[model samples]
Target: MLEIFPVYITPFEQERLIRVYLPKNYNKENKRYPVLYMHDGQNVFRDNDAIGGKSLELENYLDEIGLEVIVVGIDQNSEDRKNEYCPWVSGEYSKKILGYTSSEGGKGTEYIDFIVNELKPFIDNKYLTLKDRTAMAGISLGGLISTFAACRYPHIFTRVAAVSSAFYRNQEELEKLLKSSDLSSIEDFYLDCGTKEASGEALISKEFVASNNSIYEILREKISNVKFEIINDAEHNYFFFRERFPKILSFLVSAK
Candidate 1:
């Protein structure tokens, strides 16, 4: 089942669409299900709503696997992608991380606050959810924010996924933040990217993908349950992410 509603992001002073997915038997069953909060709501379910009309087909896949986790897809503001996705100042970050000129950013924390304090409460109140079985996952800058949320507020988001995160921008800041974070409450953490994204002179020079791999290693060393992966011949795109969605969900919706 699918439900769409408007969520007002108070920090950004904007309203966005939030798509919620429930199992077919949700109304009939009394069991509370685990929830996976995903970023880029538009690209999550329907191809009509995705970039290049490439939907994740998540519902079908979950059904095929007989998994019943609730999925909440949260939309993002495309115009301020860099600003809202960045958890730190862009200048202090690498210069060409955005594939363009340098930028001035650092509003990610504020964006996360809205998700944690506002949207979460709404979802929790509306759905029969397993409060302790909550996770946050996203792609690109969305991935960056998901990882940030996991680090900053593990009590609220116990599991996290940074799928092809935009790490090139704030590598140092991210490393410092994760190293200093309180992740005692986090249970499962997942970090991954396609081989194509990790390749090339741009991402292999100890700054982009290599550094991301290092971050995964660091997190795995520091945290109890962490998984890192590299997809063979995959690229940074919606189709690839859609294909990986099932595996990602499988990792997250474990014994909880």
Candidate 2:
């Protein structure tokens, strides 16, 4: 049985929904399963939160596929989302779009800390989880944040699934992090984007694709366990991401 709970994260100053889908074969007698932490909680399962009436239907699809991994979705605050997604605020593009006055902007580090220190510990205590076999994933801006978390805190998460990541801001900083950071600890990293996403008013720009491809190319060179996919005839929206959710879930679980 799948249990959906509303968790109040004090550090983020918001109440986010956390949905856990327990497979039918889940047993206390057996070993614990891995966990995948996903962002954009509202758009993951239902259509009401997406553009059209068609939803991702992730839970139903995963259930049919007989995957036994637990999924935790964290909702993003619309106003603070951009700031929380990007790592550094000193970049020109970040300052223009995010409107951060100070050189150090965005509470991304704090948000990740909240997830790693507060939320993960609580979930670990409450559920049967394989601590080492953990992953983080998201789409668009959320995808950007997931990638940042993976690069910054490689010890906390072993796998990452960044779908259509918005990498318009702080390209040099991200490159520095990738170069200096210890990526050898990362087990798996997945990057995917739609070709048609280039033409959209979805807050995506040329810089976005450039940065995304740059990061993808760099990761391909540095990380051995990295996978990249580009979906054709697809745009930057929930529909495309919904279609790709199954593949992402399969990849995450199969890596275990």
Candidate 3:
């Protein structure tokens, strides 16, 4: 069953809906489960709520695998997604990607603070969770934010999966932030995308292949375990993430 509730993101002063996907018999079961916090809640489940796309079908995936874990999906505010997902940088990138000017986006650190301080404490107190077994993940721009979250609160989130991250948009600034972060406590990272993500006819605002590769290299240099890959036929869409969700979950849950 999915538990839904309204959460106030104090930093943004906005109330976002968060959905929790609990395992079968959660109320009857006595076991505590590891938690996976995901961004873009609308697309995480419920096909009807998907923003012009299909749902990830996450509930079915979990049932088929028989892996009982808690998934907390945090919905994003559309108006501030760009601003909040953009990594906290020193404003080096010219506020532009594919000719579109990005907002100052320096507020991402504050956004992460909201999740770490406000949302996480609430979830931990309300649910039966394995305190240390936690991960944060996202796709595209949300992916960018997840990467930042893992770094900003390495002690809070031990694992991270940033799929097809829009790193190319704020490459320079984001790299600076990653390089300066303390990743000593982070357990693992799954960073990947498709080579075609950078192609001409692929319809992406910016090709993020090289940027993600750079993120992998930078992370590997500082952190011991970092998994990077370029899927053969993947794209910048939910289908790629949905197809790869099983492997992603396995890696993340194993880290616990």
> CA lDDT of each candidate?
0.81, 0.75, 0.80
Which runs of model 3 end up more than 4 angstroms from their true locations? 88-97, 202-207
For residues 98-117, write the lDDT of model 1, one tens digit per residue: 45556556998998898889
Quote the positional error of residue 178 for candidate 2 in Å.
1.4
Please provide, for model 3 over 62-120, each residue's C-alpha lDDT reduced to its tens digit, 9 standing for 90 to 100. Answer: 86677778999988788777777776542434344454554456677887888778988
Judging by lDDT, tell me the better candidate of 1 and 2. 1
- Between the candidate structures 1 and 2, which one is better when assessed by TM-score? 1
Most accurate candidate by TM-score: 1
Cα miss at 10, model 3 (Å)?
1.5
lDDT of 3 at 246: 82
Candidates in order, TM-scores: namely 0.92, 0.87, 0.91
Model 3 score (lDDT): 0.80
Clashing pairs in 2: none
RMSD of 1: 2.1
- Candidates 2 and 3 compared: the better one by lDDT is 3
**Tens-place lDDT digits, model 2, residues 148-219:** 898878987888998988765666677778777777788889998776685664454444555678889878
Q: Is candidate 1 or candidate 3 better by TM-score?
A: 1
Models ranked on lDDT: 1, 3, 2
